[model samples]
Target: MKILNIYRSEPDATTKKLVEIVTRDRESVEFDLNVDAPDYDKLVDEIFAADKTICWW
Candidate 1:
């Protein structure tokens, strides 16, 4: 399944580790404020495409 991980800020070590684990078998996408925030309109499309979301703010 598709998983969307939204970070309000840059990801920490734990966040990075989690992404690594989760993406091992399925698709995992991350949207971080430091990078993706400026392109929220495009990110929203991605968000909607995901089957699940993990929001870390």
Candidate 2:
């Protein structure tokens, strides 16, 4: 099964780690901003950008 990596907090920092995993698997990586602010599309775009989509928070 494919794994979708999502960082519930500090997406920018987690993005770096996502890159490493993507490089190894040659898969797509997504990013979402979660900090009490409300932005649904922003969140969706992040998940859709990746091959596998998931929510950790």
RMSD to the true structure for each prediction, in A, is 2.2, 4.8
Q: Against the true structure, whose TM-score is highest?
A: 1
* Model 1 clash tally, residue pairs: 0
Worst 10 residues of 1 by lDDT: 29-38
What does candidate 1's lDDT look like per residue over 22-55, in tens digits?
A: 7789988877766632687878898889998888
| CA shift of 21, model 1, Å | 2.1
Q: Please report the candidate that would top lDDT against the real structure.
A: 1
lDDT of 1 at 38: 69
Instruction: Name the lDDT value of residue 7 in candidate 2.
Output: 58
Please report the TM-score between candidate 1 and the true structure. Answer: 0.71
TM-score of each: 0.71, 0.38
Candidate 2, residue 48: the lDDT equals 60
